[model samples]
Structures are given as structure tokens and as C-alpha cells.
Target chain A: MTHELLPSGIDLLDSALNGGFTKPSNFLLIGTPLSAKKEVGLILLNGGLERDEAAIYISTSNTAEEARSHWEDYGFKEQWEEEGRVKFVDCYSKMLSATVSDTPSIRRVPSILDYTKLSVAVNDWCTSYYLQNTPVRLMLDSLSAFLIYSSLQTVMRFLHIFLGQLRKQNALGFFLLEEGAHEIVTFNQLKTFSNGAIRVNEESNMMQLEGYRHGMNIPLPSAVVPKATAEASQVSCTPTK
Target chain B: MFKSNGQTTKVPTGISIVDTLLDGGMPNGDSFLIRAHPLADPLSMVIEFLHNQLKNGGVGVFLVNNKSPASVLEESAILKMGLRDFKRNGQLFFIDAYSALFGLRSNEAYFVEDPNNPVSVSKVVAQALSECSKKGKVFFVYDSLNTSIDEFGNAILAEANTWKRIAIAFNAILCFIYTEWNYPKDISEAVANLFSSIVDLITLERIVATQVVTVSKNEGTPVSKRMVPIKNAVTGGIKGYVPKILVTGPFHAGKTTLVHTLSTRAVSVQRMGTTVALDFGHVNHRGFTLDLFGTVGQPRFDPILERLGGEALGAILVVDSTKPEEFPRAKEMMHKAGVHGLPYVLAANKQDLPDALSVEEVKKKMNISDEVAIVGTVGTDKVSVVKVLDLLLDKILST
Candidate 1:
């Protein structure tokens, strides 16, 4: 079966994936502490926004404003926000006992403990965008927050159901998981269901493609060099044959 | 003598809007169900009610379910009545249900050892009600019904019924707060039906936080569908109102000019004398803080306009009076902004110009309905801008 490919926004990464990620595929981003995993996720989302597509960022770690500030550092905030191509599902503020009134593109759920509410909120947003016939890019900031609040079994069930829903909607999904935060068995269980998996280690400033479910054998790069500046323009992933 | 006509005496609730809706206030021997979202704080309304009752020389019994008595007192410190003083004077009492939840013994005047035991809690509440009723009027407030349901399951229905019976027997006023979306549909409906009236405190998702109260069920008279805005307690203990208003029109229609003139602090993103993105302003008028969002008028900027239009409670459509040909574009901009059904006023800008048209002429040329208000004004005039805002606010609140 032929699969449509969407650009991952990072030119080198796109080249590495032959073209880009397959349409409607789930990618697991496993990052160590201080990794540039969030920046990678933002690049993927920026690809959709640049094409005038819709993107939803579900942040379990920070407020929507803070998440947007992080995206601003990547130079993708103003244009996407102005065009209304980006939406935020904030699950952090209420946990801190802050009341977040809903905005046009931001929905705040009361608590992350109520995964049911979060599920319903995400389902509603994806379904609405799907009905609009718009391609959707979804990013779940981190799974570590969910694991901390709920049991491993519950998180697994939620991700399973959520990924299924995204697949049915034909939307791309990026899920970030912190390394060392969970058991290897738990990480393996999540990675097994993903179409692609990448591990980011910030201490060495290196990224490796651990696996790809499609069996597309792309040559692995020996090392990834880090750029000196923090600007999005300065960062580039160089491939070493 | 307080008159009673087969019904309990009506007392004044601190909130004027609620008192008007309830004819005077909640009647004695009655219970009211306040349906609210869990995140939405209905506790403020209860605090105001209790404060009024206490001020009126009535005794109050606060049934603390989820929050501890200390927490409740801390929150009510805004009342400025000295909760400790009231408790010492035997005018205020607390039935602590939260202490047992934390496995700690409560040191309050009335403590329920086992909150999960509905029978014991109901008995304690009934005894408190009887004692408090010995005073002129007794006011009872159940901090939450959802917590009780969580603890005792279906037994909460029986407990609520017992509370109703006790309230009627002692001629007391009772208020029960329930969070929506927490329980099953049938259970919430069943609980709502058990009350004499239901006041739904709804939070409208506008740019500015807007809360309105509506009566879904009332046994006395027909309820009004018109929403009453809830006054937020501002600093210095004054009630203040804040609402969002969208400013939009055709290209070069003086929208940015009007926003700047009216707002004390206005920010506009303009490129070469034309607004490219948006203009935002904040204005304080007549106890209301209006957050105005002015959208780019060009059709190419419709996406931004739609984003800015979301959650606007009202709108101001600015049109240059001399440019009658742009009326179609003005109407299109309003449509793009998604402010069709919301309260809006048409501002005929450049009224000081020689070719400026009158409000009636602009209305006729723009094909505006009579229901919509129109005001003729120059963009730079403070008086004219205030007039336009006042008219729009009046129409918004009236609606």
C-alpha cells in the first residue's frame, strides 16, 4: 500500500526518512533530561502550520502561555497564532490551582488525574478539525506527567485508545516521553505501538533513530553535532554516513 | 411580624440580581440547587449569601464536606466579619465532614467523626438546624453534594431528602452546591428535581472572564431566560464588571483610531498606517473594565479576525461616514468576525468631515436593522467614543 508522506520540517530529518513521516503515523520521542525533544516536536508542528494546517499541542507540563513562549523561541509562534492554526489543550494550570478561562483556541481541563476528561476534550477537538477536512498535527508534550498521576496500566490504555482515535482521524501524532522516568518495560510497550521512535540524549547532544515500524532501513548517522546558537535558525541535524 | 402565606418568609440575599430572581431572596423552609462546573467557583456566591444572612441577625450552619473548616474560614476571611468572633458568639457553626476524610479529629464546635456515614451526618445536621432555628432565622449551606455522593453513593439521595424534611420542619433556608459533569446525568437530574429551585452559575468562554446566572427551575414564578452577570468582588471590596468587546469593520474604517481614543492603554500593530494584525485596548468605564479587540479589516486578514472575535460579548462596527461605498465590506467584516447575533453598535466615523453622514443616513446606506444601534462620532473625540461604548454596553447588558 502506498502511504502519503508529510514533511517533518527538519530538512535533514526528512531526508533521513527518505521523504518524511508517513501520513497518519505515530512517532514516539524518547528524550533524556535536558534534551531538545520539545524543539523537535515544535519543528514537526511548524511544518503543518507553515502549510496552513491545524495543530493541537496538549501540554501536561506548562501553561499554554509558557508553551507558546517556548514555541516563540523557535520563531513559529506569532504567525501560527495569528492565523489561528495552533490550539493548546492546557492540563497543567488547574493542577496548580489556577483558573484558566477558555480562549478561542485554548481549552483547559480541570485536572490530569481525570484522564477521561482529557480524552473527551482531545476527541472533540480532533473530530471537529477532521470534519473541517483539515490535516491535523498533534503533540502530547510529555507522557511522564500522565505516568506520574496515573497507573502504568491506565496510561497504556489511554494512549492505546487515543492513538486509535488519531489514526481514524488520519492525523499525525508526536508523543514525548522522558527517559529514566519509567521502567524499560513501560517504554518498550509504548515504543512497540509507534510507527517510528527516536531517542534524544542532550548530554552528548546526539539523536538516534532507534526503530521504525515500516521496516524502511535508513543508514544511521554516527553522531549529531549541536549548533552554538539557541536560535531555531542555528540548529541543524547533520548526518554522518 | 413577618408575613407567611403557606410559604416561608423571603429574606434578602446579598446579591441583588439573585434577590430579584427569587422575588426577594430564598424563602425559609426551602432549598436551592446551584449547578456549577467543578472549576468554576460557586463558593463566592455562597459566601455572599451567608454574609448577608449573618448581617441580618440570622444564625448560619455551614456543612463542610470536601474543604476543612479552617480552609472555609480562610476563604471567608474576605467577609471581614471575623469568623472567629461569629463562632464565639454562637451565631455561626460548622459541621466538619472533611476532618475525618484526612484521618484527623476535628476541633470545631460540631464535628462529624465519619463523613461517609450519611445517617450520622444527617442526624448531626438536623440537630444543628433545630438549635440554629431558635434564633430569628436559620441559614444552612451544604458545601457540596458531589462529595457526599462520592462518600456514601446512592445513600446521598435519602440523606438529601432527610435534609429537606428537616429544613421544612425547622423553617430554615438551605443551599446545596453541586458541580456539573461530576456525576451521571440521571443522578444530577434526580438531585436537581429534589430542590425547590435551581440556579445555574455558568462561565461563558470569552476573552474576558464572564459569569452569568440563570434560573432553570423556580416554583414561585416564571424564570427569565435573560442572563444576569455575576459581579466579581474587586480590590477594596467593591464589585466590578469586566467584559470583552470586538472592534471590526471594512478596511481603513477608523477602527484603530477609535480603539486608541477610547482605551487608556491601547496597542496597535500597524504597518505604514494600516493595521496588519490587530489592535488591543483596555478601558475602564462605569465600574466595568472593557477589553477591546480590534481586528484587521481587510478580507485577507479574516483568519486573525475570527480568532480575535471568539468569546466577544459585544462588538463595535466602525465605518467611515464619508465612504458609503464600503458598507458591503463592513458587513462582510462583521460576518467574518462571527459577531452576527451578539450585541453590536455601528459607529459612523469621520463625522467631523464635510461629507460625513448622519447616524440615520449611515444606517440606511449600510442596510442595518433597526434593532442594532448606531452612533455618529469622530474617531478622535473622547465624548463620542464614550457615548458609543455606553450605548453598546447598555444594549449588551439589556440583552
Candidate 2:
């Protein structure tokens, strides 16, 4: 299988992101609670799915069924139910099912280092279906929720190993984060570990996207604004507060 | 038949209307003592009087040195009674005593555990009255003469007497003694000795019930009284015809998302999955605007969100169709809304997938009151979300 950087295929978005996503690069997406960061992740995943790319979803908080239901509004229900390429690895459910507390236990709940135990189980199941089907994209919905099950350091260590496995397979990756990480020390650690980073902020009515990439910076227009040509400068478009 | 004292005398009724209600103006020069409570509406009378004098282009020098001058001015501004055009004409001189009236390091005096020195009180009052008397026909208003009694002790009466002597000497200065009527016996006696007997015009501020009755007293003189009914506008905060919709339920019940879907704009202080705090949104429906608050499902949340809705609400209890177990929590919110007699609607949200419970199943899980109108919804769909509000309207209209 050949590894290729994935394009969301949304022309404006692809241009803003500098010719689409870079393979094996971990990108950080930050936004106000309801500023639509998760929605962007779902949109990108859906675009990949449309291209027939097998995607793996790792949920730290929500259940697989819940995530599936949320994306139904974005037109992913039928595509997901039909092909099992879009699957969920629910850590929350697994921990609950095993009745093992990451804390107060004789043995600490396994961190990302222990993710191999899970991936091995996943690898075995995938082999039963098809031996060599490599996932094209992997998304960790949120890391903050995972901290509830394990310490930030433990989770980060686990993520380093788990994400290394995805990078070895050349899978595109992105992490969804809440704005509260502005105070947490772990967010900076993630930023240092990632190749690129983007921040989303909603000022009044429009969502603004800004980021630094490879020493070059890109400033995207409001999430819902259209770029106009120089000739159309007479016709101005800006959201009014 | 009284001796012709060569002094021009005027008394402040502390009210503009009563001043107008008393014709062109009252006597100026001599002090007219007004007795009333600290919270008494003496301000309304004083402002209306000043407003009338102001509207007539009657330029008068006013000396005010209250720490809360801004708030007092704001209250007067809202009443539309005092010195509306005084600032524009640049005639109202405000004396902020925040830095110098007291003998302390600064005029920033909050409470007086011990009474103040009479000398300092006399100096501030003397300075204020002298400035107010500079222009001949000036309506000299000393807001509350008694405030200084705590700091000035009985020396305030001597100061008032000295003020009387100066006005007699000027023959054009008008002195008005403004203070709470039922003051401490000592202070009242001291103030009375200086201004009461010499008062040419007396206006008794009467608040009998909500009605304001002004009685102008004279010794063996014909009675001249005026009664005005004061109507209060909406106090505390601005209220409108907009309906308040409170969205609340168990954790992960989609209440915040439902509000965002319904509102034109939204603000949520959320963490990862569950709401660590509250969410807010403003929705303008057909002709009504709704202020929506999505509170956390905890029991302590009731008081904060309840006050946010003020009087009543048009609440919506959001439920996740996929999570029937959360229905009991939603019902508890419904009961609280019922206590306010606020009409509410149930939003059976997340009804897009096969795993989601049907509307009938959700209704059975919740303690659906006869008052609530339940509707199935997909919050992500704008049109479907508006339909839930439509049901809320029908519920409100029926109730």
C-alpha cells in the first residue's frame, strides 16, 4: 500500500490547510466548547470515507453508538453501517466491562503502553476479516477524557507508543482538544510532540482558524466566509456582530 | 408686620414639581429644613424642582460633594426630574468630597465610629453655601445637612447659625437644610434651632402610602398643599415580551446541543463530553425572542438558573433518544418548571439512528405531565429543532 497525504477535498479548506493533510503528522485542533471543532473532525473523516479509505475511530469518552448517531447529521450513518471500515475502539466501555479501575488497583490500569494489548486484540480481529488492510486515518476524539482514567503523563506515554504504531503504518492523525487545556501543562506537551497545530476561535458570529506550520503560518478566513477576488473588492462580505 | 430683615430668603422643597407646584420659586437666602427618612423620596422632589429651574434657563450654582454623586445622578436621570440640561449648560458645579471634606488624610470617609470635628464640618458647609450664594437668584440646595452631624457633632448647628448670619449679611443667599426628618434627637434639635423658627416657607415631605403629600406649613397662615401620586417604573432590571426558555436534564442528554441548534447564537462553558458549567443562547422565534439557559443536571443548579429566568419561563427538557435511562432526570427538571407555572416542552432529541428509542418509548420513560407537550427531534437539523419550539408555543398558548 502506498502512503499519501489526504486532502479533505473541500477546495477552500484544502487551500487553507496548504494542499491538504500531511501524512504521519499529528495536528492539534482547539476551539471553544461549541465552536465546531468536533464537527470539523467528522467532516474530514467523512471526506476520507467517501474516498473509500478505511478509517479507525478511537473514542475516549463517547460510545461508538453515540459517535455514530452524532455523525448521522453529517451523512455518515448509511456509509458506516454498510462498511465496517469506520469502527470504534471504545476505551470507556472496555474499562467498564472489565471492571478494572485505572486507580486504586494492585496494578495500574494499562496506559498507551498497554494499548498494544488492545491493538493486538484489534489486529487479530482485523486479520480474521482481512490480513493486510491498513487504516488510512486515525482520530482520537479527545485526550482530556482519557485523563480521568489515567494521569496525563501516563496517557501521553501511551499515546506516544500508540501513535507511533499509526505512524509506522503511515496513518494520518488528528486530536480534538477543549479550550480548558489552555491551563493544563499536557496541551503544550502534545503541541511539542505534534508536527502542526491549529486553533479555532468564535468571535461573535464567525469562527476564525489560525495556525503555524513548518515555520510558515496560514490564516484562514472565517469558518463560514467566502474569499473574494480583487475585482470584487467593491462587493464586501463580513459577518456583522 | 414682622421686622424688615434685609435678607433675600428661599427654601428648597427638595422637589422640582412642588417648587413649580409652588409657582415661579420658593424663598431664597434662609434655610428651610426638610425632615424625612434616608430612603425617603426627597430626591424626586429636589430633582423635579431643579429641572423646572433648569428648563426656565434659571442658572443656579449647585454644590454637591457626595461620594455617590454618580449613582445619585443616575437615579435622578432615570426619574427625568433633576438637572437634565444642567450638565449641557455647564452650570451644575459638583463638589466631590472624596478627597478633601474631612480632616483625615483624605475625604474617603466610609463609616464614623467616632463623631467628626465640628470645625471641619463647618468649613465644608460654609464653603458649599458660599459658592451656592455667588449668583443672586441661585436655589442653594445642601442635599442632607445632617450627614455632617456624625462628624461635626453639634457644631453643625453653629455652622448653620453662621450660615444664617452670612445670608442675612448678603440678603440674597437661600439656604436649604436637607436631612432625614426623624433624625437623632440631638442632631434634630441642633438643626431645628438654626433654621426652623426663621423658615419663611416650609414644605413637609409626606409619603402617606405610595402617595406623596407635600404640606407647606405657615404660622396662622392659610393652607397651601399639593398632592402628587408617584408611579414606579419597572425596577431592578429591564423586562421584555421575550419568553425565557430553560433547557436542563441529566448529563449527556443533549440539552446544550439542543439550545445551540435552536438559538441564533450560543455560549457554552463546557469541558470534554459533559457540561462542567452552564450554556447560554438567544433564540428569536416567529415574533418572540427566547433567552435559553442550559444548566448542569446537578440539584444545586436550580437556584442560579431559576433567578436567570426571573419571573417565569418557557422551559424545554431535552432527552437523548439513545439514552432512555436519563428520562427520570429530565422529569425532575419538568417538575421544577411546573412549580413556576412555566409551560414547557419535551424534546426527544437524537432521533436519527435505529438504536434511538422511539418517541413513544421516551414518553413512557419520563413522568410526562399533562401540561408538557412532547415532540421528537433531531437537534442537528435546524428545521426539526424549530418544530420543538413550535410545540412550546402551542403549549404556552394553551396554558
- Residue B204 shift from truth in candidate 2, angstroms: 99
Here, model 1's chain A TM-score works out at 0.86
After superposing all C-alphas onto the true structure, candidate 1 shows an RMSD in angstroms of 10.5
Give me the displacement of residue A188 in model 1, in angstroms: 22
Docking class of 2: incorrect
lDDT, residue B216, candidate 2: 44
TM-score against truth, every candidate: 0.59, 0.31
lDDT of every predicted structure (CA atoms): 0.75, 0.53
lDDT of 1 by residue, B1-399 (tens): 143345556676766667656666776687888877433467767877887788778888998775666655654664453455677788899998766754778777788887768988988888888887886578898977765665566688788888888888888889998766445577776887788778777656421235677777775444665565655562222233545699999888899999999998999999999999999998877656678999998888888878888878889999999999999988888888888899999999999999888888999888889998888988999999889999988887678
Residues B154-249 of candidate 2: C-alpha lDDT, one tens digit per residue: 666676677666665554334443543244577655565555322222212221112233434322132355333232332311112233567777
Candidate 2 per-residue lDDT over residues A92-145, each given as its tens digit: 443233333222101111222123234433333233233345446666777666
